[model samples]
Target: MKILDKYILKTFVITFTSVFVILFFIFILQTVWLFISELAGKDLDFILVIKFLMFAMPRIIPLVLPLSVLLASIMSFGDFAENYEFAAMKSAGISLQRTMKFLTFFILILSLGAFIFANNVIPYAEFKFINFRKDIAQMKPAMAIAEGQFSDVGSYNIKVDKKSGENGNFLTGITIHKKSNNFDGSKNVIKAKNGELISNEKSNILKLVLNDGYYYEDIIPKKYEERNKIPFAKSSFKKYIIYIDLSKLNNTNNEDYTISNTNSMLNISELKYTIDSLENNRKKDIISFVDNSYQRTVTQGSLSSNKALNDSIITTKIKNPDLLSNFIPKEQSEILQIANNSIINTNYTIDSTEQELESKTKVINSHWIALYDKFVIAFACILMFFIGAPLGAIIRKGGLGLPIVFAVLIFIIYHFVNTFGKKIAQEDGLTPFLGCWMATFILTPIACLLTYRATNDIGFINMDVVLLPFQKLFKKIFPSQNQ
Candidate 1:
């Protein structure tokens, strides 16, 4: 290898490594802030906290690696240009493309490595991180009552408006859902104006003392016909005490804990399988719903009866426009009541089916987005390198000053577009493939333009290209006498 190639590779690698570490640390701090509630005041051991962060750190690589490439490329190349090293290389017959040969190959390897990490490492990390969080939440029964949001602890989902006092045992505006065998929904709901958590470390139970509370229990009817009545029991109490068993929760094994089914936890093959299964299930559901709706709304017997009635009416040549007038009052009323009930039931079914289908579709879209995201990470690294390397040469400014400004502005646009696309795709406004690649598609031309300008030794903006046509038009319109 030539001395020049060695020097260039060494400089770029050093800058890339430094930038990667700094950006990774910054993003890890952000991750800690995001999950602080799961850690803070939970009395978790230092080793557990470190494990939590370690499991979460892999997810940050996709975000950090590309940005590092962009900033590092710009800084390293811009420093060369600013120091007139590029001019010396050019005088010695080294072209910009020639200088980029080794670096391009390096970037290709980096991109491949990124793809491998995203496909394998990120999925594993996500699985561990999410399950670890679940285990941590139930590590202590008291940790389950996180303020402002629902926290699943054992069979009860607990939430509190505020928590105060040492150890945050004093709770305000508490709500709890006791999920028993009823997978249909939460059957028992407890709401309180205030509550207190009383626990003994030696015992396997936690005592919840409630003040000014209401208990609501929904009644399930044994008779199928009476199910629609929506019966329930509600009672208010000045003070209520409930015991929550902490034996299973305090056990850290989590053997009975249900694993989370988020898209982030699945690799490419798993995602494909899941997405296919979900789609097939959705199809089967739609077909079943349609058949059920048809049977409920219009049966074969009803259709035959309606046809007979229509034929009879046509043959009788009834002059009256009001069909109900022919029936007795009792029959008419009965028929109207039955019709109203069928309409109400059909409407309900339609609404519920629509919501279920929409939810399933969104879930499928999320899986597709996750699938495309792995490849996007690989492409983003290459895209950013091309943009940053050429941009540096064109601008000819080094250090953290101008390079930082350009990098931030460009990266902000990329991040914003990427986020917007994913949001739209999640809502089914756009296809997942397009949504995932939109930012790359939008910024690719900028990279090409920068590369071309830098290769030809043109400045940042080519004035000749911008003004040539305008100059010609001006001369033609003015009709210069000299011409």
Candidate 2:
């Protein structure tokens, strides 16, 4: 590298590193703010909390890296412009693009790094973060029950008035509500004087033992049956035990329950696989629905129990009303009944087919959208560098004051567009490719324009100069109007 290139590149690196560190801390604090409520009152271990913070960093890195590129570019170029370095370079025949050569290469390498991180580190981190949360959910037997609140453990809701014992295993004044099963619409309510929690590790069961409790089950009367009195059961017991399956709650050994195919947890290759599979399924389902509907309509509408009736109907374009009117009264009634049956069956089939198609379409859109988002971080970082450097030079200012403000404003626009486009894509409103790259498409031209203006030493915003002519034209058109 030349001496000038080395100097400029070194300055850019120093500013970039500083800005990245500051942004990392800010994002970490934001993470803490978001999840503090869940982590605060749990009396969790310090080491686990640190691990939680570690797993969360990968998710934040994707968001913060783009912003860092933007802010760093703004500061570096803005500082150079403010110090008259560009003028000196212009005198030496070094164009603005020439000055940015080394930094552009550096940003390209960073984009590659961002892609690797998104593919490898992000998927693993997402898996770990979500798995750790599930483990924490089943960490302790007492963790299931909170003081003065109902804890939903499977289908049972257990509420406790107060907790005692060294590990919060003993409770007083407990109420248990067991929700109705599919066979019955009656809920069973239990009021207990005291309770104790016992964990059976061998069987992987959590036994909730209640003492001095009364169970009440209310039965609803059937409309077709006459009852003299309300059918209910009241039972009093000295002790009762409710068994909860710890295997389901822990979910460590079960891949079916623990692992997910959600878009957030898939890498680029997995996303592509999912998209292909979903699209294939959607096509097959559509074909099947069409075949089923056609078969049902033709087969059900035939009265001769043969293909001859269907062939005649299709060949002659025979109307069912006309055919029924020519028959005697009884035969006409039978023909109308057959036609009505066929119409009802066709309507049901169509409704179900529409619902199935809608569901598959949503799944296909999800996979496509996820496939598109895999490139977002890498592309965003590279794009932001192009945008920020030229904008910084145009503004001719540096440091946290104007640089940060401009960075934030541009970042907000980028973020809003991305989020809005993604939301629309999720609902299958636009093609996945277009929805994912909408922000890039909107901002690329502006970046090119800014770069051109900065190279020519033109103002970023000269709206008044252009608007002055229009104002004069309007005045000529209506001289006495508002003014």
- Name the regions of candidate 1 deviating beyond 4 angstroms: 140-243, 246-257, 300-345, 467-483
Reference-based lDDT, residue 311, model 2 = 55
lDDT (10s digit) by residue, model 1, range 313-345? 345554568967766576456557667777787
Q: Write the per-residue lDDT of candidate 2 for residues 31-121, one digit (tens) a residue.
A: 9899875576455678778888887899888779999999999999999999999889999999999999999999999999999898888
So what's the TM-score on candidate 2?
0.87
Model 1 TM-score? 0.75
How many residue pairs of model 1 clash at the backbone?
0
Flag regions of model 2 displaced more than 4 Å: 200-203, 223-232, 251-257, 303-321, 463-483
RMSD for all candidates, in order, please: 7.3, 4.4
Candidate 1: give the clashing pairs.
none
How close to the true structure is residue 155 of candidate 2, measured as C-alpha lDDT? 71
